[model samples]
Target: MRKKVVALVAVLAAAAAGVVVARGCSGDGTSKEARPANPNGEKPASGTSPEDAPRPMGSAVTIVVDASAPPSEKGPEVLFSATWGGSRMNELGRSRPDEANPEAPMSLAMDAKGNMFVLDQVNGRVVRVGPDGKPESVIPLKEQEAAQDMAVTDDGKVAVLDRFNSKSIVMYDEKGGVLGEVPLEGEGLDELGFVTGVFVDGKDVYVEKEHGPLLRIGTTDGQPVDRTEVPGRPTRDGLSYIKAGIIEPEAGRMYISSVDRATMQHRYTREIRQGSEIRGILLLDTDKTGTIYLATLLVQNDQESVVLSCHEPLKGIPTGTAVLPVNTMPEETFRDMAVLDEGGVVYSVRTEQGVSYQKYDCQ
Candidate 1:
């Protein structure tokens, strides 16, 4: 039954390609309210329930997705919204295209200044948007095929994760000048895994290396600082592999996700490596709070995903647990997640159709 479901999901995702503007309900089965109350206690027309109030469901947080603006004269204006409690998304704002291409968008990043950086994977270029949803600049990369994940620094430096060449992480100045590249070394890079994402803090950069572990490196000279092994084994069902990870500097927390594992064959027999059985999002903290928040999705036997927060008061000690409510897209699967200073999260959901950008505000 699990195999059948997984196969069916893959088929539906492949069919969603090329089709623009697809609509579906969230796992919670709630639609976007036509008129909803504002965060400041003002009603907008949509009905409001006390239950709708943003609350923490364990590690699973509340999110809202809105349609900000429609397609513009050049084309449909790109709008970003959060997928919170209801099915409907909240309109954050529309973003204009820096370069025009009919291909669907893959990923996006927003700076503190409201400047939007869009990664058009198909075209192998990065597009920038101004606060008013206008095109600011278009950055063309020399090696488009290697570009995978991206991050923008507070000082406006752009870092692109390349999977093709020896240069793993490449940094560029605000004007698109080559700053430097992080040399892939140490036990983490020696595994020769693909980098899923790159995030920059003040002077440190955190990288999620696929199939290996989380790597921390210095941005100034690309020197490796530390490497943390990712826990969890792949399930025997051969469902998915580890995809991406995120780190929160303020909270000293880390989250990792798995997608599918690979099967290996020897001379006489074939062996299947069980992928990360504890498949979901994991929260790791180094602040002496031995608590770990885990969000898991069972894909092989059952199609269910939940969030749980587990804590240990003292080292090597155990505490109680709590379950949280998390809503996911029916067709879209979450690939990456990042936590903010206020305990909020921004995640990337990838589907055969397109990539869905979602933000979760957790109290």
Candidate 2:
């Protein structure tokens, strides 16, 4: 019932990440010397502010393929794939299969070492995958039913958005030991409702509550640090409310995705200043320069759904767009998405054939 729905949702979420048909990029045979440092070493203007100098737009490229496309031999440059339905289990890299208790693999996080963690919603646990893609450990929750989202710290600690109880970000050690839980403390969060996304960096954890505001919590004692309203137009219909966040510690950038009604799409937009107006209405990963992949279900267009990617930015401005092909398995519907370390995305799609793998390379 609920567990089955969660399993299905997990697979769909994988498809949302654009994991179909593995691909990779290669460099040309020539090399050039590095450019000299700027004499002024001046910082470029920010992309949003008029006072800031405009940043250079990088070149865009796309990779498309049919079902017959061959898988890469170099392992996945990026690993994004689907999960098993009705089982609290998921397969990684076609190698390791992990089983968490209660069988609800809702969210995923990976570390620099290639270790993966799956938020098991039904069993109220988080299962860790080792470097070899096998189950390493599981963090158990006593009463939490729906552990919705997750993020991994640079140090390998896991932070999770526990939706059912208090809706707080719970921190755990790499070995599944409980560190703390940060509770939301602000207006509109009294109910402690569902948290759709969780992101961790250093000792800070950010939680995005569904239909509510975003909360910043301390990783030390699970205390609320800051609360701010999300700046975006409210979505009415055909909206997928799976909010995802990524933090660029080096650039101090935070990227968040929300559903947009104008295009009847879910697009990722960057948030520069806290509570500031969000201007960049494009889909991009943390790198900000890679391919922009999208999973769409255009019900108005005869229920036609497919995974798509664009090398160019997709905002109010018009740019060239392209669609990547994937083999469709009956009964599978694309769901949510996450970018993997290897420059590819992992996505979950529904199919009668059960959960399967699809890899794409950004040309």
Candidate 3:
């Protein structure tokens, strides 16, 4: 069984300097200009603030689908669809907000057997939804600052990264039994910033702090092992930290979303430095062949997202890739996304209607 993998933002530079500036990427036909360094050195405002950011609202939602595109070449097909947590009443005669009261989904992971573990950040619990798209079980963790991200293992063990607490990663068994907890302090804790990502590969668990040096831990005993620096750690100032990462252990490579900086380098690279219009990267694993699926968000240039397929690796420049847009509503705010073994991509979005999950099939 392969546990669910969530997109992790790379913690770098700004963190070392203790700043959170929303420096947009510039490349791929766009101008490469440096954002001015904050003089006072205070944290800069994000591109979108909480007040202006998109959120699920109202009592109903309108879903649109483009049926003309084929799943294989154009990306995943939406085989089945389900909705959760909204103001509208569900089959149980309870409004979504009243039933589960789920906040925006922070992170999610899926096992090889098609089981999904979703971190309901506001609720502080892991909701496991079966292949049928029905809620199977709910595992709650009490009294934590924030349950940020989660990953599942092939053997059915789930690991969660909870921020603000002394210990960061907590593991759980299939029956919701407590396995163990790993404290995210020591070594590069200060420079690494927060526990941005938790990945389970075979018997070893990979924990990513804000910057570089991804930590390896024992999955069975929860013991820390060697730490290796991730590819593309900046050597000087003016460079940006990693924005997000998707681990494809089987592929022997992890895809990292980063700023448009030439100084940074990675071990195995697939980049889309198409300027700020490229919002983020979403990774999906196909059950058909276990190949990694890469999707880049193009919010500014187009209202939809793009799915890319490339066989060759490029050093710096963007590749001539097959790009297909996944049309999404303008109001939808991508919270988190996970890839299913069957080449299906499941993602969470906050719309004016409410937070909900949607699945798209990939080839």
For model 2, how does the per-residue alpha-carbon lDDT over 5-121 read when each residue is reduced to its tens digit? 000011122322321111211123222110000000011112322233122121221222231334334543233333544434453221122553222245666675767666655
lDDT of 1: 0.37
Candidate 3 lDDT score relative to the true structure: 0.43
Q: After superposition, how far is residue 193 of candidate 1 from its true place, in Å?
A: 1.4
Per-candidate TM-scores read 0.44, 0.51, 0.56
Per-residue lDDT value at 148 in model 2 = 58
Q: Pick the candidate with the highest TM-score.
A: 3
Provide the lowest-lDDT 10-residue window in model 2: 1-10
* Candidate 2 regions with alpha-carbon error over 4 angstroms: 1-104, 188-195, 209-213, 220-223, 228-284, 288-294, 299-301, 310-335, 350-354
**True-vs-predicted CA distance for residue 359, candidate 2, Å:** 3.7
- Candidate with more favorable, higher lDDT: 1 or 2: 2
Q: What is the C-alpha lDDT of each candidate?
A: 0.37, 0.39, 0.43
lDDT of 3 by residue, 1-363 (tens): 011111113333232112111122222423221111100001111232224322211111111122222345433333223344432222111123544443455676788778777666555567777777666777766455456667787666888776566366777888877777776666656633445467665666666544223566446446566554443222112233233232321111223333324555432333222322434344422233323344444344334334332221121212122334443433211125675655546655444344455665321
Q: Report, for all candidates in order, the number of backbone clashes.
A: 30, 28, 20
